[model samples]
Target: MTVWILVTAALGAALSWLSCRFLVLPLLRRRGVMDRPSERSSHEVPVVRGGGLAVLSGFLPAAVLGMLGYGLASGEYGLRSLVTFDAPGFSVLAMGIAFGFIGLVDDLDSLSASTRLLAQVGVGIIFAAGVMLLLGVGFFAGAVIAVSVVYVVNAVNFMDGLNTLITGWTLVCALWFTLLGALTGSGSIAIAAVALALAAAAFLPFNTNPAQAFLGDVGSYAIGGATVALAWMSWAFGMPVVAVLAPFVVPAYDVLRTLIVRMYLGENIFQAHKSHLYQRMHQAGLSHETVARIHAGAALVCILASVPAVLTQGWAGELVAVSIWLLVLVFYSYGPRFVKEHRAKEHGSSSNNAGGRA
Candidate 1:
């Protein structure tokens, strides 16, 4: 079963890569629908934006096969086992696609903030209501899923300003989730994580610093959806520590911190800007590659550390892992000041900006 799941996920990731290299990427390039830099952009040249369509290739098929398998094996339509079509999970996927489409429209042409907000709300309702119905999770959970999903998706989109930041983090999360699934004996979790991780790895060749391609809005929302869905399912089945931190610690921390800082300055939380801790690192003189490496390194470290935490099957390792990651979050937020400042060294900041993200 493990071998089969891994093979299936590998196929999905490989297919997604091909879609990017051949269909999705070429279509974007030919249409000249590329990401161009401005004050909001961290990159220099016009690169393809809908690169995340590649993720859909991996995610969508995995959802179908996995869900069908679960339904057959468990004798229940456990769609949550696959793509999480159940309420909260369904809503998460829906909202992610919604926000992603908004980003996609923004990529094609400017969209009003209201329009984007509406779509996000629509998706949020689905996710929130689903959790309420199925898991009986609560007002706090509803709010958390709704707000966290939007912010994380947006933050992920924000992080996409660089080369592989989104992809790199996503890759790390996926690998960690896969191992967590393996240790805990959850096939769907392992399948989903490995598939997405492989997809990230496949794209890393094109997305590394001085990246040839950008994931755009499509990719950001997609990654956000997958991250939330995986976390939800992992927790629903058991109290695994990896399931908890995978969504909240790495991605959620940055979003919450950024929102607080922006609100403190009386800025609209929804507006786009380049002031994220990672962005600040870029502004303060760290190259996109260096900043990306540091964060990706953190993610990799989390993966390594999480192994024992999951294998241990208790809260002890998880608690330690969470503390370490939380401490790193503090550093991620406030650490740049200690580094020697370098001024915005990259002129065409866009290209070099494309480092590790998601």
Candidate 2:
């Protein structure tokens, strides 16, 4: 069964790569939906954007395949069982695809913030309602979940600026969820985890630093929605909130600090700026890969540290996760300053050396 899952994942990745390389990217380029470099941009050249549609191509089919396989093995109608209320599973899958469409629409026209927020809220409510109806949760719990979904979706969208940052970070989170699923004996969670991991893997090649393509709004929104959905599933399946949220702690901290700082500076929080900690590292002469690696490494740390919590579901686990989260906040606040100063000193040293030689 594991081998089949692995094969399915590999196939999904391959299909995603092919779809992006041959279909989505080419179409976007032909339509001139490229990301041009600007004062607030990270890349130097225009790249075909909206490559995240390829991830959808990979993830959605694999998820359907997983559903079918599970259903047929049990002598049930494959897709029929999935869409029914026996499980809240279909809602997870559908919400991801729905948000992707919303994002694609916005990418095409750059919708107003209020419009996008309303759309996200509506989707969140629908997802919460589905979960509540399927799992028999009360309205209060459902409302909380709905609010969390909105927060995560927007958080992910905000952190999608750098190449391979969100893509790779999301992959790490998905894999952690897969591990958690395996440990907890939750097949649905594991299936979702693998699908997302493989899809992100397929998208990573084109989206790395010096990327050939960007995720655009479509990729970011879809990835965000799917991730939050997966985390919610993990929590619903009995993992502690700390364990479920640990994978995202780094990104959450970074984004929160950025927002607070922006507000403190009297800047419009909605306005675009190259002031993120990761962006600062990029401006300090770190390559895109370096900055992305830094963030990814932080994500990996959070995942590893949170593992015990997922496994034990105890105060110890929660404490460790929270501690790591606090540390990540400190890093997010000061890491960029350290990198910037180091880069400045390095530049000064190089100048002094050149002067001495000349």
Candidate 3:
């Protein structure tokens, strides 16, 4: 099983890198599928979009093979296990592909917000229904899951403004999920996590500073779908809820706060804006790489803080997780201001030194 997981991850990484480099990137360039600078764009020049197709291309085959290998090796089922709907991995893969399609369509021809929302809701409900049937949960729980799926999809999309911000963050979260899945003995979860981690890592080089391409809506939506699927699978396997949610604290806070502030200011909630905390950090003179690293570091901290919850699986663990979230929330809320003030103080100190020298 361990060897299978390793092989699956290696295959996924190789496929993702090769596809992105040789297939998707060149195709987008030839087709002129580019994103030009805009008011909300973090980049100054046009870059290739829809690079996420490579991620999906890499992840889909590896994920299917991984699950199939697991089933056959465990002697649990036959080849028909490939289409088994009960397997959480199947659901995860299905969601990623489904959402990726919607995003692809939107990327090629920008869809109306209402149209996109309706489509996402439809997919979310289907995914939630699958989860409900698998878990035998009630309709209300299914609805909650459905809503969470949609929210996460948009949350990830909303944070894709900066280069490697969402991609790197997703990699960090996926790595944590891989560990969690292994510890909990959830083969589906572990396999899915490993595939996701490697795919993201493979794509990271292309998306780093001076990004050669963007994930666009396709990559962000697909990543969001897979992420929520992994989280739900972890919970379905009985991991602590707090532990499951820890990695998401930073993005959730950024999205929710941005939405609330936009509403308060009477701005269009659906309108693109450079208001996210990470975006603000970039606006405040931090480089994209620095801002991305800061958010990734914060995510790592939240994941680590939630480790206690996985160990304890009780009130103590939940408390620790909640505390870490609160601390992170505070940091996100005031972090922009803090950065501005620190920069101001440094500027003032520099001025004083210059005056004394004069």
Candidate 4:
């Protein structure tokens, strides 16, 4: 079964690659749509940036295949709740599409931040409503779902600077979910996890920094929506919040910490600036590609650290979460030193404060 799953992923990845090469990129380029590099951006050259459209080529078919396989195996007319398309599941898919469409338009026309945020709120409301429509669920669940959807959308977008930061973190989260599913023999969960894992893997090549393509709005928005949806479903299945959190704790904390600091410093948190710790590294003369790989590697370590939490139950999982979380706090405190050193070198003859505003 594992072998078959791997093979399926490989095929999906290959097809996805081709779709990016022939379909999405050509269309985007031919239409003269591309993100031009500027003084504020990292890339020195103009590269086609919306290649995230390729992810759908991988995500949709794999998810459908997972659904079909599960349904056939179960001999049921209704879709399997695990990986198949059902009411809430289809609603999740619709919200992703809506988010991606808004992002695609933003990439094309450079929409204002407020404009994008409004669209995001619309998508979030749809997602929250779907989750709230449970058999006996109530207003508390609806409130949680609404707040969570909005937070996930913005938080995930915050981590998307540099090359494959968001992509790498997403892959780590998906792989953790898949492993947990396999360990517990939850076929539906495993199927959903594997589908996401394959989609993220397929996106890796293009997303690596000096990224041949940026996730732009489409990639981050859709992936973030799907991730939050996954978390909501997982929590609904009686999993603890820690299990829902273990996969995202690092990226989530980074965003939250950054936001707190930015607010304290009187910065417009909504403004696009290279103040992110990772963005600082890129400004400190590190190549975009190097920064991407470093984030990816860090996410990989986080995934490894999550194994025990993913496999453990109850307080055991909480223990692992607490331990890894403290480590992230340390990283946040000292992580800027690496960037500061490089900044100091570039401006040896002048006084510059790159720590707060790179």
Candidate 5:
């Protein structure tokens, strides 16, 4: 069974890579679905966006098949296993795909912020209502979870100013969630995570610094929707909320900080701005790769923090995890200041070198 899952994951990654390299990129480039550089952009040149569709190409079929396979072997779905349309995994995948389509439309037509928010709200409510019906969650709790889903999706889209940041961050979270699923014996989640993780890995080479392509809104929407859906389901089923949220600490903190700062300054929160912590670091002369690695490392710390909390199931373990999160939040909040200092030092050294040569 494990071998089958592994094979499915490998196949998904391979297909995703091939699709992006040969199919999606070409089609997008030909159609001029490219992202142009602007004051808000990190890149100086345009690159093909909407490359995230490759993820669905690679993940959707593999995930559906894996779910079916698991259902058959475990007799979890009886004969209906072959047609998994009613399964939770299928529901999540379908919703993600739908959101990705909406993202693609935005990529082409550029939806207004209010319009996008309305769409997100509608989707969130429907998703939450579905969860209440299917998972037996109560109305109030489900509504809260729905709001979280909206936040996660937009948070991902907002923080996606740098090459490889969103893909890398999502990859880390997916892998962590995969591990958690395996530990909890939740086969559906484990399989879904495998598909997501590998798909992101396949997309990374093209998305890294000096990127050949970007995920655009399409990819971020899909990734964000799928991630929150899976985590919400896992939490509702049995997993602790802490374990589910641990991997997202960095992005969550960044989003919250961005919102608060914007509100305090009387700036509209929906406006496009490169004021994110990672963006500040990039503008301060940090390379895209450097910022990505830093964020990935921070994500790793959060993942590690989750392990003890999951293992101990005690207040002490949870407290320690929370403490680490708070500490990291403080560091991230002051990250811009450090970047400015580093940039100043670099500029000074360069000036001294030029003067010495003169």
Candidate 6:
């Protein structure tokens, strides 16, 4: 089963990479589907957007193949049995496509924030209700899941400002989920995570500094929806909540802090702005690659720390996870100020040295 999953992932990665480099990129350029430079944008030139179509092209087929493989391996080949074999993973793929469609419309026609939010929430509710029905959870749990889906989808979109920031971070989290699933003997989680990782990996090359194409809202929304779905699936598999949530810690903190600061300063929270911690770090003189690598590194550290904690599974595990979370949060929160202060000190010392020479 593991071997089959690996083969599927490899094929998906190849297909995703080829489609992005050939079909998607050419179509976007031909159609002039470009993201132009703006005050809130990190890039200086227009780049082709909507590259997520390639990701979908790769991921959807792979997911279907994976589900079929799982069903056959389990000797449950009926349509109903296949759908129920891994309800959460199937739901993830379904909701991801729905969200991707919404993003595609927004990319082309530019939907208003209210409309987009409404659409997202509506889809989220359907997803939550489906999961609740399949898993036999309560209405309260379903409501919480719905809210979480909305939050995660938007948070991911918010964090997608920098080159390779969201893409790289997502790849890391997917890899972590894949490992967790393997460790826990959840083939569904492992297969789904592998497909997601491959899709992100295929997209990474184009998304690097001097990006040739952007994921646009389509990729971000699909990735976000898929991420939350996997987290829910992990929870259902009896993984510790902290472990399941570990991958989200960095992005969640950044998004929440940015929103709070914007609201406190009386800025329109819905307006586009380069106020995210990662964006500020770049504006503070760090290169886009530097800032992106930093975020990816932080996410990796948090995920790595979660392993032992998850395995331990108790107050001790919770303590480790919470402590790591707080530590990273403090670092990210104060990072910009620290950079500014250091630069100021350097300038002051240089001025004094010039005076002495004079």
Best by the TM-score measure: 3
> For model 6, what is the error of residue 299's alpha carbon versus the real structure, in angstroms, after optimal superposition?
1.5
- Of 3 and 6, the candidate ahead on TM-score is 3
Q: On a 0 to 100 scale, what is the lDDT of residue 1 in model 4? A: 40
**For model 3, which pairs clash?**
none
Model 3, residue 6: C-alpha shift (Å)? 1.3
lDDT of 2 by residue, 1-358 (tens): 3654575578668878999989998898889888878777887888887888998888888866775675466553455657672433455577779889988998788899999999999999988887787579999999998898888888888787888988888788888877776666655567667787898898888997668888888888888888888787777778888878887787777777788999999998777788778888778777787788889888888777787787687999889888887787677667778888998899999999999999
What TM-score, to 2 decimals, does candidate 2 have? Answer: 0.93
| Model 2 C-alpha lDDT versus the unseen true structure | 0.79
- RMSD of each candidate? 7.0, 2.0, 1.4, 5.5, 2.0, 2.2
How much lDDT does each candidate structure score? 0.68, 0.79, 0.87, 0.67, 0.82, 0.84
lDDT of 1 by residue, 1-358 (tens): 4664667577767877888788887888888987778877888877777788777676666645653564456564465544555422233345446666776787678678787767776776676677667688888888877776666666676667778788878877777666666555666566666767777777777787677778877788778767766666666666475645643465566666777889999997666688777777777777777877877777666556555566677788777777777777777767567553323344436456675331
Q: Tell me the RMSD of model 2 versus the true structure.
A: 2.0
Off by over 4 Å in 2: 74-78, 85-89, 355-358
TM-score of each: 0.81, 0.93, 0.96, 0.84, 0.93, 0.93
Tell me the tens digit of each residue's lDDT in model 4 across 1-358: 4643564466557766788768887887788777787644766777786776777667656655654565456653245443334523344455557777887888788898788878877777767766676536787877777777778877777777667677777777766665655555444455555666677677778776556677777878777887777667666555566667765666677678778899999998767676777777666677666766666665555555555655665677677767876776576546568677757777863545555465
For residues 65-139, what per-residue lDDT tens digits would candidate 3 score against the true structure? 887888688874457656765666777888888899999998899999999999999999998988898789999
List pairs with backbone clashes in candidate 2: none
Q: Per-residue alpha-carbon lDDT of model 6 for 22-65, expressed as tens digits?
A: 89999989988999998889999999889888888777778678
For candidate 5, the per-residue lDDT at 170 reads 81
Q: Could you tell me how far off, in angstroms, the CA of residue 303 lies in candidate 2 after the best superposition?
A: 1.1
